[model samples]
Target chain A: MSMDFGFDMITEDEYQRQRALYEPLTEAVRRLIYASLHTDVGADAAAEARTKIEAVTALLETEQRASVPLVHENTGRPLAWANPAVGLRNAIAPPMVIHHEDDGSCWSEFTLSGAYEGPPGWVHGGICALVLDHLLGEAASEGLTQPKFTGTISLRYLRGTPLGPLRAEAFVERTEGVKTFARGYLKDADGATVEAEGVFIRPAWARDAG
Target chain B: MSMDFGFDMITEDEYQRQRALYEPLTEAVRRLIYASLHTDVGADAAAEARTKIEAVTALLETEQRASVPLVHENTGRPLAWANPAVGLRNAIAPPMVIHHEDDGSCWSEFTLSGAYEGPPGWVHGGICALVLDHLLGEAASEGLTQPKFTGTISLRYLRGTPLGPLRAEAFVERTEGVKTFARGYLKDADGATVEAEGVFIRPAWARDAG
Candidate 1:
């Protein structure tokens, strides 16, 4: 089945402008999140901070979008500013920068702070799954040229991943008609900690468009 | 084979007090996140908001925890305030409250706003995996009477889960010594959109303690 969300197409200049507008804000919010967890401020200080934060929220709410806009760059790349994985405007996403290799593989190097801990100092297993899922989907999408959705993804946690500098990589294993199979892993300084595989399917609409 | 992070045990009173202090702040940050995405405020207002947020962060930084503490309720349940899935103090978490059923199953009902969107209005697939993994782990843990780490989890996306009210439920399918097999699904109003199965493994330390 096919579905349409009516994505808008924007000029490259507009994409760059939006990027410039939102990226730093997203970064600031990310720092706020990390601070919220580690902050040992007194109750009164925290309450006052909350009030300041709420005032900022109120000011922002003065003007709002009905829904997040789905736009495509003039170069045909999808630009989703609200995506939790890699959106330039999403503070919840890790500061991941995925590198696309010439051989159609994707890899990212990033750091996880205390916010991502699951087992004590180790990273959360679900966070590991989240990163792998996105990287694998990117590999399956072939740099967004195919635009596939995650059909099935599986992960095995070999050992605990420490919450610090980490690396993840994924590559398309094979493609069968509309579905692409991809595999990847998360690694620390020592070696692989989690391995993942996924199947990504090109939607009927995208296939039809092609 | 085993590890220790020196989790502290907190009194019920302390837990309640901490909860009271942080829950509202977490909620406020959640609203801030939503507003940050939907806000159409002019650049000057947005920049001003950033400055105010930075000030708050600086105030918080005056006192900070070296790392996120893994605490346990006096009654033994893990209390991870930084958990992205169910941390009461984590703003990045969608507001979810899991209810444990007598039959060893766990379920939660929550709404995903625009911040969780992946493909336009649908929830991010990685997010589905995140929630499912946590729910399934909770089920395997049997209300934290026994602790287990996710060994492997797999999900199949049957359809898109819209970004609104959704329900997720998980239960233990079986247990084989150190491993517990669990299954779960995410559903919108109409029906199930994603199905998942997971293996939760009791660490050697826990087994030895038993």
Candidate 2:
């Protein structure tokens, strides 16, 4: 039904490192949003919020995660190796949890809210891009084997992305050297109306070792 | 200072031909948006809406009417062409436009409102994509005789795009046959923060005689 070749990516160790690095932040974002919504607490809680936020920021201070990346033994070439710093407190995270991480792809889910609205009662287009960027960013990493920055992305809005609760899905479509192609969609319960395709590149500045 | 490159396009005649051939819904959109805001007034009425709202559509219609597209010669190319089709009117204009011709660089702008809100006070991300897609789709067509579909688009969200009036700008950077590399950014009026950046493409399926 669609033209997709599926990307071939990194290794299990790299996957774990990426997950451990991002999951905490994702979890923190989820918690912060929940607290912001559920608690009737006022600005005085701003300090409390900082404390709570710090609970998660603590993860970044712990240690530096290393990734050897994938390599082709015969060619003696480093297969894929790239990582970029995606600073904490991501703008979009409907409380996503990294569910599974296989060799060449990663899967996660998040909900939407009033904070991300645009047309009438729909999610803002920028928020849609934010969600997809992260999804595609993860997908582009090919399940942590290599990390890449989006070189390009295309989006099709089939229907209005309603506000409130929505979901997004992203996965790798294919890979050629440092370039990784991916696709993602964001939708309300029914189906996708906002779809995106992206190409991610592992920049030359990134670490590389065979 | 910015990353967009829209200074160079092709001939005005080719622009006219390209415009004639384009099928974007811009005019329809202008009419729809005008009607929605000026609900009780007819197009014949001169001073209908309040300052910021009145003639908004007419002004757009005028600009749409006056703007000249750049189309390539033997290899007619520019940055986007739209052949808008007449369409139905409603509360808000739909964000759809057909691009006719391109020379690889240009800029596009559109405004949305509560009609596209998802959050209580924020705009929807999907709507952002809609506008961005239209602009990128236009950029994708640049420097080529015929237009192209989006092969990929990448977006970066630097901050939350506030609700109310906003603008989108897209232009091409370079071209490589079927692949045209381009970037765009969406900025709120204050300009303090950029909601997003986009890198879009023109697919091979859309290529025509150079």
Candidate 3:
């Protein structure tokens, strides 16, 4: 018996709603991250951004209710780990994603609220992992050299990946036999920050089988 | 109310049974992985191991189905993504792992069966991502590192990571403020094969409030 499962489609309106809800405050954090990497911004900057981000996210989430539908039970949403539905209880995220299709490159956005803070108020280290995982995974599966999942992934945080309105972009790098390689960057609004590379493998099961 | 979740301990027999059911095959694969990496042997050596691994794991699963419920729903085990019950019905694993205790490193493993085969008899690529995520996350959370998740990850698959009994190890290299920097390697019994690096962040949310 054969069946069709809907795995590749998500609406644009839903995307906008999520984006508005996340309200990422991207530009500010981007500039701040750039400075830290290029200049001797010190640890205080991460602390400052964490604090500023938490306050902003707190205001956005105040109106949110803990009781919400869990759209992601399995195929974990990228930011679902911290959703209020789960009680906004833990801000850390694992390497899952909420993918939206794009023509040229894969794009995704998520917000880091109080739950993700570090220092006096900054995004936590683990949260960065979740963000990158979601973004990179989505990138690997789409418009890339070939659809591969992470065989191995590496990251260099050049600087603290501040909290709040963050944006991440991923593009395919190259391919070899059953392996596909990719590179990506996460930025608030500043530019050229938090770089990463991932190996997407088309498991023996899914490969050629398609 | 203080609550105690009955997960902190396990019986010695249970440990042994678990090892018998899970570890030996993984070890065999690990040995092959090491050989594939350090020696002049081609990736085909790992391929040979995967075949042996699949045969062993299938028999183990059939033999232990009654004694050791490998499926998550049947056993009520928390890390269902790696459980066969979620129905990959194969040897490949998802990249997410939960129920990690204070082991200093969090890890999940599965012996690739025919179900995970990519080539005539190889494991799938996506499954590799699932394993690495579990490894790197565990490594970051180890000791004074404050258990941060992956902020960013980079992976280099020097060659096809053969499917078989495989071992992935991750450990912290250093830390920067609230972020822990770490690297991990996936090795077979012989030596190093796939290497990875990541930034583990202790999200702002998990910190104790003053």
Q: Compare the candidates by TM-score and give the number of the best one.
A: 1
Q: What tier of docking accuracy does candidate 2 attain?
A: incorrect
Can you write out model 2's per-residue Cα lDDT over A67-111, one digit (the tens) per residue? Answer: 223343333323322211121222222434443355545555555
Off by over 4 Å in 2: A1-92, A101-103, B1-183, B186-210
- Candidate 1 regions with alpha-carbon error over 4 angstroms: A66-74, B66-74
Model 2 lDDT per residue over B1-210, tens place? 111223335666745543333212223223322223212222222122222222222222222222233335534443322211001111122333333334544443345544343222444443455456446545655423334444445555444466666666667776676666666666787662233334444333334534
lDDT, candidate 1, B43-74, per-residue tens = 78878988888998898789887664545565
Worst 10 residues of 2 chain B by lDDT: B82-91
Best by DockQ: 1
List lDDT for all candidates, in order: 0.83, 0.44, 0.43
Looking at candidate 3 chain A, the ten consecutive residues that score lowest on lDDT are A83-92
Compared with the true structure, what per-residue lDDT tens digits does model 1 show for residues A67-173? Answer: 63555664466666777877777777785777889999999999888777777777878888888988898889876556689999999999889988999999999
* 10 residues in a row with least lDDT, candidate 1 chain B: B66-75
DockQ of each: 0.72, 0.04, 0.05
Per-residue lDDT tens digits for candidate 3, residues A1-210, read 121112323355654554333322222222222222122222343334334433333333334333222233233333222221111222112112344555545765666543334322344443454456546655666532233546666666666666577777777777688776777777876764567677677866567768
